[model samples]
Target: WQAKKLCPELVLVPPRHDRYAEISRQVNALYMQYTDLVEPASIDESYLDVTGSLPHFGLSAHALGDQVRRRVREEIGITISVGISFCKAFAKMGSDLKKPDATTEITRENYRDILWPLPVGALLYAGKRTCEQLRMQGIHTVGDLARTDRQALAALLGRGGDALWLAANGLEDAPVVPPDEQPAVKSVGNGRTFPRDLVTYDEVRRALITLSDEVATRLREAHMMCRAVQVSIKDPKLKVIVRQMQVGRPTWQRREISDTALKVMAANWREGAPIRALTVTAENLIPADQATEQISLFDAVPQKQREKQEKLERAVLQLRKKYGADSILLGPGDEEH
Candidate 1:
């Protein structure tokens, strides 16, 4: 309401994710023209390692960046900021230094002069809490953080403090992974904010089933199974609580995910408490083919029954693919009831 009052002329627009993905593909194609070593960080950002292509393209790093920027604007009809540096972290920092259509280069010699004067919060992963902690210790600027004793900083902030100290001193060595060389699946999750607050176990149960179903579907699509399930609940006041539990075995079955999530919720959530949002996440993933389930001596659900369930779910997946996504529904209860 305050934003509307302050900017009465402001117009809101809904996001078109499909269209954005299409545009991202087009932009990435342009990046590939210069180097095969393109790493897409997000839908709108990418890092192009043009070191090998420098001789082939007959352009320096800065010059290559300018060319890429120009081609993106000309072909994709969107302006992009470019950053050229010896390392990935500093290059990302340089990109944030300007906006729209611009290029910034951070070299080994000049990084100290350019980056040290900036606020510590300007560094990546330095959030409000970290900033407050740093300020309390008289570490106000990036320089202050860089100059702080690494042992003392670690004592103050744990492992994260050591990482920040390294990043602050330009020792961050994380590589930019190309699209093809990206790491394996870590976790898959789905969440929803309801139109009305859910105040009953039944309501929460239905929501969890819906979220878990989607998460299971995604895991199967990726040919992965999760050994753990995590749930996040947000109340009407927007305070959030998260809980996770290890599964009996790694499984991508919707029933298993939903059941585990409900158990976690029962253990952590207060009964009849109003919740505005809920999320279900499948964690500690392993590839379905590589997953070796160890049968417990007192296991209730036998191996054969679990295999049959997997087959049934795959058949359902095929039916959903043939028809529309909403053609079938699983689970025992309906939200409308």
Candidate 2:
């Protein structure tokens, strides 16, 4: 809000994702007035499948889209832009082109002309890191990439580079997969690249613990559990090592995840070498109810320790949630000096 005052053009507000989601549901409902086949991409974006309903709506797809946007502004107190397209990916891309809080459209014919010459950053899946790499290679525009050979790009940027090629050609095999089949909760992971190289095992372990707590809190927030865990590290020179482990049962239990993560860190870490980064990932997630558990003998901790850890974890979560993420103090930097 303060930033908006400094520059009037700056659209600023404390992001209330929950509030936006509520408004999104209402906007999606308005869209359903035009067609039932609506795919919500995010709180601020949705793709409407208006294939057969245009006839009864008494409006062309564009006209129906205009009405939907107007309805959201008039009825919900928030403005929305709609993009009518044959597929989800294009619909999103079309919406992005008009985004300063407005709506636009792109038919199959206009897609190539409209998207081809635009900067590579304009493409849907073009990531910040990828765009910088392209800029470094002197390929600033999508057209330059589209004209490049696939094999050469793959060699330069691996599979990600090839994906850029496909997107630049306006060629992608992705489907408008329904949200349910898309898996509501897919992954829980955290990675941090320290600004310096770290040489101490204890220091690296502290960073891993912090990341583990974050990953576990995220999983619990989504009411999900993981059956697999993985750990990765990068040396000062950027050499990478990774390890994956399967749990006997799925668990959202932060303690279990932390224990396994620490074990991996202990096993895979270079004994006394400087390292620059640490990453931990949990995959094969399922709802908490579906997770399995096991009886423990030597693995069990003392009740006093468990209670103390639980209190600390809950306090940290409360403080972090109320304040920004960096509000809490944790371990020293794990990067190589």
* Candidate with the greatest lDDT versus the true structure: 1
Against the reference, the lDDT scores of all candidates come to 0.87, 0.74
Worst 10 residues of 1 by lDDT: 328-337
State in Å the error of residue 52, model 1. Answer: 1.7
- Give the per-residue lDDT digits (tens) of candidate 1, residues 1-337: 4566799998877566547767999999988888888899888989888888899988888888898889889988999998888888788889999998899999989989999999999888898879999999999998899999999999999999999898888898877678679878799999999988998888899899989988998999899999999999999887999999999888999878998999999999887889999999999999999998667777646777778877887887888766545667754563211
* Model 1 CA lDDT for position 291: 90
**Per-residue lDDT of candidate 2, residues 4-86 (tens digit):** 66798986555554455567788878777776666677667776667678788778878777777777888988876666565
| Cand. 2 Cα-lDDT | 0.74
The superposed Cα distance between candidate 2 and the true structure at residue 146, in angstroms, equals: 2.1
Clash pairs for candidate 1: none
Residue 25 displacement (Å), model 2: 4.1
> Could you tell me the lDDT of residue 110 within candidate 1?
93
Q: Model 1: residues >4 Å from true position, as ranges? A: 1-11, 189-214, 217-221, 232-242, 246-250, 253-259, 272-279, 290-337
